[model samples]
Each structure stands twice: as structure tokens, then as C-alpha cells.
Target: MTPPKLRRLATAGLIAALLAGPMQAAAAQEPLVDHTPGQADIEGGATAQQDTNSLDASLSDAEKTADSVLTVDQMAANQRALASEIGPDGSSLGQGIERLATTGDPQVAPVDADAPTGTAAVSYWRPSGVYGVDVSSHQETVDWRAARNQGSQFAYVKATEATGYINPFFSPQYGGSEAAGMLRGAYHFAIPNVSTGAQQANYFINNGGGWVNDGKTLPPLLDVEYNPYPSLGNSCYNMSAAQMVSWIRDFSNTVVTRTGRLPMIYTTTDWWNTCTGYSTAFADHPLHIANYNNSGAGTLPAGWTGYELWQYTSIGPVVGDWNQWPSTLSALQAFARNNTAPAPSAGSAAITTLAGRTTKLGGATSGVVCGLIGGGCYQNYQRGSIHWTATTGAHATLGAIRTTWAGTGYEKGRLGYPTGPETCGLLGSGCYQNFQRGTIHWTTATGAHATLGAIRTAWAAHGYEKGRLGYPTGAETCGLVGGGCYQNFQRGTIHWTSTTGAHATLGGIRNTWAGTGYENGRLGYPTGPEICGITDGGCYQDYQRGAIHWTTATGAHATLGAIRRAWAGTGYETGSLGFPAGPETCTLVGGGCYQSFQRGAIHWTTATGAHATTGAIRRAWAGTGYENGRLGYPTGPQTCGLVDGGCYQNYQRGAIHWTTATGAHATLGAIRSTWAGTGYERGRLGYPTGPETCANNRCTQTFQGGTLTWTPTTGTRITYK
Candidate 1:
């Protein structure tokens, strides 16, 4: 007949931490635990009895105080004050009594041993990559071999468009994909302008080889995107929720019966969520989601733990043009198997600058424009195409645009605007708009005609848009729905490779055939030749001292300083293992012992401790430094750090001379990261606040103000230095 009790038992340690105030909530909530007492309340009641005793004592005091109170309200106020001292958090005296009722005590209730235990579970998921191809005339040769060679694992070959029409690009690419050993499937970009689902299915079935070899390929996919054409059929873009579902179901079932694989659905994140009410319906089906980002920057569906695959990074360069391509094959397989899903792979991390870190701008201003072949300039808009409706925010400039000259007649060079896609090439042969936006336009004139510069569409994070090539690179490029290279071409000389390092070599010309790792240069020609075997080498080392020099194949040389230098002790003979007696002997003995080096320099301990010639040590250390700073071991020097409120090299300043600890005045440098992370200082000091002094390499004051606080040249200091 007793009311059910809910007693919460908390440990003394837990109580202490609880009173410490809120930090951060755990990642997930704990599961409910059962809390039912099975045994009689002997031990449990003991703690409750103590709380009851305390409550009684307090109540008795309140009663005695009330009995002597001058008025009822005054007595009540006193009672409230007394109750507050003994209450937990904001619990009122009445609330305490109510809570204590279940435990038969007024203090904290004993934790229930039978209460359900709370625990966390992890998500069981994996990611799969999906490869999508938008075939048109360019991919007629669909080389399955090339696709496989490039690591393509699955193919969603274009089948039809919205006019109940088949894309002319599909057959050859499909046949090529088949020939090249790629796992293939067909998809119809739903044509709302055409017939009903049954009619569309019939057209697809008849045109798509009768769906006879279903097992040979993946199930047919539905490529649903924005279908703006309203004339053929209004059904393409607008449909009731029920009608849309029914239509999809019908098309899917038809494909399933014919292909022997379950039909899949491919769509943009927005379309899937808004147009068809598919957010809930498609959860159980294989969905190929598209969110165009250089990395996964697009919105995604909620509760969409797994997807058949994802479309990421579409700006892949191949065959003289950019084609969208999947960043990985594993992501496709995982999606197909219903194991896991991935966001787009068009990674856009924060770019660290001397000014501090910043989020990437949404368009062309965010990318590094590149040059292309056949006498044209290429601009790689970090994202995708520039959507320049007059309403679109645009900054423009007057410039030459290549129409039909020099092959594709597009222009070359960095543009003065930032409106177009990541990459655009221009030719100067025909009439064209002579204006540029969203890029820096650079043009070159040759005799009768000039190469004009044009803006390309922005390169959205992971998405891509194909551009027509008057002259093709002969090789085809493919992308995930959002990832790929937009082919830009003007015929010159062609080589069959995806060497993003350099432009495609033209006609075996030595200048065109750059080698790999050297930023794709013409074959047999030295572009950025790296000399690694030299002493104290810079990325372009050219001289040899404490430093080394690099001579460009183009006949340019650059000098670089030695990364580090160490002196051998006096009394040591050149290349011999002994010490000198005096300073003069120290100079003489260590004359040849000046150890010039770079980071990661090493000397064999087995070798006798002798003063090797400084020249010899310099030579050995040349072009061998791999670390950023001196990480020398064996007795060269300790790590460099701040001393005397300044960065001291090689732990240069001794304890007395160096007044501050290593980290006291030194700062970590900014880093290029996609997410927030720790940074380091590359032997540079933060700006100074005021005049600071040091003598004999020692801090004059207990603190040096100059390097202590980073001050702004501006009147007021900014948020971050």
C-alpha cells in the first residue's frame, strides 16, 4: 500500500565533483537503469534515518525559534533563512521534505542499488565511396582500363535525361566503362517533362539494353536533380508527395525486376529533403547524396548514418580537361554495402596567414588560379562555377576573353576578377565578351591574334561542372557527383596521363614533357630540379657555405644558409679525437671542426670523436636536413627555445645569460588546418609591446616588455595577434 519510492544514491566523491559546477555535458545521455529494492530496508534505512535525524533537529530548532518570534511572517523568514543553509542547490525546504518522503529521511536519499544502470554505446558504421559519371559526347571512348587504372571502383553511368531522352554521352562511356573493367550501372536523370514512371521505365528498358544483364551491373539509379524545362511535362519539377513516392517506387521496382538489383536513388541533399518529402521515405533505400564542396561542405540529411555512397571533389584534371572524380574508391564500396557513408571529400580547412586564421570565402577569391595548355590561361576557382545572375554579388573588370582563337580561343593568365569556376582557359580567335569577374585577367598577344583571359565558374568545395572543350585532351575525366575536374582544352600536344603537376605535353616537345614530382614538367627538361645530395640545401639551394646553392635548369641559382653550425672543443686535432689546451689551440684545433649542418643531421657515434674539417661537416650536412629546427643529438646542442625573453638558438644563452624559460617568450606558429589545432613558432618572435633590453644575451629586467605581449600597430589591440 506504500507509494513507490525513488531514491538517488550518490557517492561522497561524486557529491564533491557535482558541487564544482557545470563543465561540459557528456557526449551522450546514459541509458535508464532499474532502481527497485528487493530486500527489506535495513542497511538502506540507516542512511535515511541519519538524514531524518538532521531534518528533525532543524525542524525542532525552527519550531523553538518560531515559538519566540514576534510575528508569524518574521518567524517564517527566519525559518527560510535557516532552511537555505542546509538545502542542496536550489531545493526548497518543502521540496526537501517531499523528496525525503520516499526515503523516510530529509537529507540526501541513498542511491538505489536496483536502479537501471546507464551506459553508452558506439555507432556501428562504415563509409563507402560512390563513383558517378555524367557522360556526354566527350567520354565516347569511356576507357574502363583508364578508369580502373585511376582507381575507380564503381560507376554510375548516365543513361537518360528529362525528355524521356537518352544522353548521347552514355553509350560510349558505358561501353568504355565495360571494356575498362569498371563495375557499372545506368541512371536516368528523372525527366518530369516526359511520360509516367511506367512509360519512362519502358523507354529506359528498351533503350538501356532491356535490363537483361542486371547482375552484371549495379541496380539502375534515379538521378533526380533540378529539371527546369516546363514544356515537355510539368511533372519533372513539381509533384505531390504521394505522386513522387509512387513514381519513384514504380521506376525502382521496374528496374529491380529487370536488373535483378535493387534500384538506387541519387539526388542533391536539398531535393531529397524538400521536393519529395523523401527525408523519411528514403532512409531505408540506397541513397546517393550530393553536396558540392571541395570537401564535404554541403548540408546533409539527419539520421542518415549510412548512404550508398557520396559525391565528393569533382575537379579532377585529366585528358586535357577537368572531370569530377571520386576522392576514394573505398567510400563507394562502403555505400554500396550499406555499411557506412562519408561526407564530401572536398576538404576546406582554415588557411593560416600572418594575419591569423580565417574561414575560406565562398567563391573564386578563395582559390589559386592555374594556367593551361595550347596557349591558354586556367583559373581554378576553389569551389565550382560562378553563379552570376545579375543579382549575384559580383566585382567586375574589363578584360580580353578568348572566344575561338588559339584553339578553343580562350585567354590565359591570372584574371583581375573572382566570379568564375575554379578553372577557365581562353582562346582569342572569335568575338566574345571582353569583361572578367572574380579573377585576375592576364593576356598575351602574338602577331595577329592575342590570347585573352576569361573567368571560370567557382569551384564549389566538392562539386564540379563540365566545360566544353573545342579541343579535347583525348583522355576522359570522371567525378563523384560533386567532385571532378572541369575539362578545359585547346589542342597543342597531348600525352595520356593525369599529371596535375604540369600542363599536358604537346607533340613530344621537350618543353612540354615535364617529369613528375618536379611539379609535372616537360620530359627531359628540368623545371624545379631538387638537388638533395648537396650541403645546407634550401628547397632551391645553389651556393655551398654554411649553405648550399641550387642551379635551375633554366640557369638560375639560389643561395641558402646552413641550417645549423657547431664548434668542436679546443685541444682537438682536425679529424682526430683529442682536446686542445687553450683558446688559441681551441681555434686551431676546432678550425676544421666547425660543424655546419641542417636539421636531422647525424654523425655516427662509432666514429672517433675527432674534429672533422668544417668544410667536410658542411658538405655532409648539406641537402640532408629534414627537420624544421635543430634536433641534433650526441653533443651538438640542446633544442632551441626562448631565453632572456627572446628565442635563443641551440639553447644558445646559458642559464644566467638567458633569463626566461624556453616557453616563456616563445610562441607557437600558425598552422594550416581543416579544424582547430595547436600551432608552433618557426623561430620567430611575436610583436613587441615596448622597448626591452638585454645585455650579454641576458634579460636586463625580470621581464622584457618587448616580446612579452604582442601589441598591435593599430591604436587598439585586436582579438588575436
Candidate 2:
């Protein structure tokens, strides 16, 4: 398919001038009086900002990459400027195809390393695989359903070309393929000498190359080959091997940020060797080698060990260039679904991120440059700077830490550079630097801080950003309680005392410590670090007073006083009970205090002291209405190992006995006196079967062997079972 623009009058004078002239930096003649969403600094570097040339200037998102662009007059002026330059009507995909057709240039590197060319006859003989077609504006109204009938499993539609022109038929061709139940994708034609690779890439994506993980949209393809406009520039577009590699890298990395998948490279081996100087940098990128031949995709370019697809011929089965996917159809569909959509590209990434601050940053000290450690790009300004990576997107770094980083040689510094923005939601409203050596945390209260070594290690142990401490608020401060130093975090604090070294005090344990007046209180400073991995996922931290226990179901709570002693005797968290569920509650019956655990609670009082009541006995006490009921707060811990595997705990008023056979039942008041006379669990009555029940003013307690009946009118009476 040929471009209609080819019919326009040819300028012989302009043709010679453009072909011989060195490429000058192109600028846009657009006003940059304001800011829009994704608009970055001008592509023509500092000169474009000065508006020196009447060329194009990228002022806003609309002017730069978005669909809405240039005023009618400005658009017409740009079209007029390039009126004679739209020479070749062919797509980049067909440059080598036509060249091989006429000149018999070798489609593949000759089997003999010294051979210069090969026959064109075998180049057009189609090879077998799952086939597909590629379309451009030339195939304007494609009957994609007809193409599907022709067994084209996938389709690649030309979305944009050279940063200026978008295929007018891109929508119907791209959409119609999917509508006809075929996989489809978008591709861009390279005019490397015309604009930056990022510019052309952004233009392509904004037009129709944007992808969704719909299992039908293939990875965006980059159609880079011999320059179709030989009258305008040479085959390699005047780019040296290094520049060409950098240009492709810039374009690819930009696409990765926009869509998670690395783009499929569509190029023939001959052009690749000529342009990239046989560079092996892009081995990871999937290759769609264009070697139109009856033989295998021969002598694949430098990097790729295998090809994903082979463009067998430019001659169309219908309306476009047809290619083959050697794998099964399901494999191709799986390929589409595998690369889920990633974060959308912010046009030029770092440049776009730094757009709003262009005025503040002044003019560019250098052009946008990439090929960093992680395929990131950066642009320097008179003040500050902006850096971008696929993982971190784009963020500007300034202030003291940035100055320090810059002084240490930017990315070559000890900490590498800030990977993200100086976000301020951290502890004490601080900021971060996710770097290599150590993070630099800052807060208004403590200026700036960069910590490594032991302090940072302690912070890391507490879970870094997601931990209880969260992001550090300020630098470590040495001084107070037990000659200790402490660093504050978002939610808690890490204290390093001479005695206990460094330990985190946060969450409920910290709250409990606060209640006791912290270090000044009974607990004093931590005696040892918090040790976790006790039974039932519990942790304990020792203090001068006692220790705090923590768990997922129960929060961190301190075990102190007499209740703490009783818990310790029972093996703390590993005892009959588990971690502390809630804080200690006081002012119960007789001014008693109690703290709940995973199993039960430890009740403390002046008379009953403290006793760990758990399991069946505790439930029996609860049934008897706790400390206020017939069976008051437990006076002794539950004791087991008796007849019938029975366990019992003595209360203020009576006792509750339990066995596997008889659940648990409290025998108190008159029943207690009667049961005691018969000897508890050893007499004829045995362990209590169930709780006492009252009806018609008569209360009866059933035992394992007999029944004990009592009432106000009638005294206690025992009946044998």
C-alpha cells in the first residue's frame, strides 16, 4: 500500500539539501505560557525554550503526545514546513523488502561469511507457520473477517510514524481484527533522525499503541529498519551505532514503563547489523525477525538466540505484509494474557515529572539522556534535577540529601540516587530516598538524617516501612533514660540503652508502658529485647518490672503485679492460657483486677491474691456468675491428676470440680457443705455432673454418682444415683 502524499510535487533542490545536510535539532513553534498534565520540558533542549526557531515546541500534553494537538494555523504551518519531505509512500517494514526485490541484497547473512548477496527468488517463497498480516493507511477499509478466513491468526496495524503522522485507518484496522476474533497489536515506524525515540514512542502509544491485558492485544512492535525516505536521509538515519542503540533503548524503556511488557522488535538482520553495528544489548527483547525467505529465519541479529515470529514476505495474501508465528495459536494467546497491563507512561517520564518545575529548574543544562544502570533517563537544569526509572517512574530530588548525593558523584555515590520523590507522609511528616547504601529520612523536627550500621539494622528488623516503627522521623538522639539513645518512627520509637542495646517499643506494649510513666515507672528500661516464637504465635519483652506479651489475636499487654507472677508460674504464654488479649482491668468485686488471655483470665485481689483460672473450671465459675456469684474469684490455681482424671480449683465460697465424664460444676453454699462432708471427688457422690438448677424454690445439684437437693423450706438431702 502506498501513501497518497507521494503524488505531491517533488522539490529537487530541497531533496539534495536535505540528503546532504547534517541533521539539525528540530523545534516546535508552540507557546509554553502554562502547564498541563503530562507536558515536559521542550524536546529541542534549552534553545526551544527561548523560542529561537519557528519550529515546533512541546508546550502541553495536548501538544506533546496526546491526541488534541497544535492550533489549526500552527498545524498548517508544520504541514507546510514538511510539504516536500514526505517522499517515500512505503512503510518502514517494506524498505528492505523493496531493496532486496530490486538489488538482490542478501535477505539473510550469506552462509559464507564473505558472501555479499544472495538470490531474491527464495526470499518470497513463503515458509510454513501460523500466519498474520500487517496493515497501514494504504489498506484503509480492511475486511478483517475476510483476512481471518485467509487464516491470518494475528494482525499488526501501523499506529503512528515518525512522531508526526498517525495512520488514519489505525482504529478500524486494529479494532476490526479483534472484532473478527483475531489477535491484534499496534506498531510504530522509526524516523530516528527526525525526533527522539521517546517522542516517536509516546506518539505511537498515545495514538493507538496503548495496550490492555485483554488476551487479544499483542505486545507493541517497533518497526525499525532502513529509512524509507532515502531522498531525505541515508539508510541508518545518520545515527552512529552507539546513538542508534541508545535511541532504541530509550524507546523500549519508555514503552516498558507504559506497558509492562518489553516490546517486540520488528527488523531484518541486514539493517540491524548496518545500524546497530551487530550490538547484542537487546537479547531479552523478543525478536520478530523479518527475513522473507523459504528457508529458516537465517543468521538472526546479534542478541536474540531465537525468534518469536518471522515475517515471511511483504507481498500480501490480502492487503498487508504477512508474517508467521511458529508456535501454536494457544501459545500466542497465552503470550497476550501473560503481559498484564502496567502503569501508563507519563509521556517522557522524568521530563514530564519535572515539567511543572521547568520554570523553577530554569533551562536544561543538557539534553534528555538515558542508558543508566536501570535504563533510566535524567535531565539536568540550572537548579535541582529529575531522574526516572521503570520501577520508580520519575521524581525530582533536591534539598540537603540530594546535594550530598550530587556531591558524592550523583548515581556513582555511595547511596546511588533517590529512586523516587521526596514524599512527606512519613513519621513526623518526613521524607524518604529508597537508595542502595541506606535510606535518608528527614523530618521538620530533626532536619535531615542518613543512617546505616546498627541503627538501620534494628529498624530493618522491625519491618522497614511496613513495620511498627514505619519510616524514621529523625536521626538517632543519644542521652536520656539509663543513658539511652532513641530514634522516633511513624508509629513507635526504637530505643538503644546501654543495658538493652536497641529495641522497638510500639503498639499496645508501648501504650501500656506509657500508662506506667514509661522508663520512669515500675518497668524501668527494657532489660532485654523482645523474644518471639513462643507457643501460639506469642512474643515477650522483659523489663525491670515484668514483661509484655503479644500475638495476632491479642495485642501487646504487660503482665505485672501478682497476676504477672501467677502467669509466669504457669509458663506465661506457653501455659494453660496464651498471650494477653486485653489490658488489665481493675475495680471488680472486692477491688479485684483481671487480665484476659487466649484461654482465660488471671484474677487478682487482696484476699484471693492472684490465680490463673482456665479451661472447664473457669467456664464453671462463669456459669456460677464469676466473682459475684456463689463461686467467687479463684483462691488457688486449677489442680489436676486425681480419680477419673478430674481437675478442681477452689473459690472463696466453694470449689468447682471437672472430669472428662462430668464437664464442670461448682458445688457451693449448702451443697458445698454437704459435698465436703462426703469428701469431694472421692466419696459416693464423685465429681459434679452439671451446674446446679433451681425450680419452685428448690435447687438441686447432680453428681456423677448421686444428686444433692437443697431449699429454704427443706434442708439439703442426698439421693444416690
Winning candidate number (TM-score) = 2
> Against the true structure, what is each candidate's TM-score?
0.27, 0.37
Question: What is every candidate's alpha-carbon RMSD to the true fold?
Answer: 33.4, 23.3
User: Residue by residue across 239-265, what tens digits does model 1's lDDT show?
Assistant: 333345556666666666765555666
Off by over 4 Å in 1: 1-134, 143-146, 209-216, 230-236, 319-721
Residue 225 lDDT in candidate 2: 81
* Residues 491-549 of candidate 2: C-alpha lDDT, one tens digit per residue: 88777766676777777677777787777787777766678788766677888788888
Tell me how far the alpha carbon of residue 246 in candidate 1 is from the true structure, in angstroms, after superposition. Answer: 2.3
Please count the clashing residue pairs in each candidate, in the order shown. Answer: 133, 8
TM-score of 2: 0.37
Model 2 lDDT on a 0 to 1 scale = 0.68
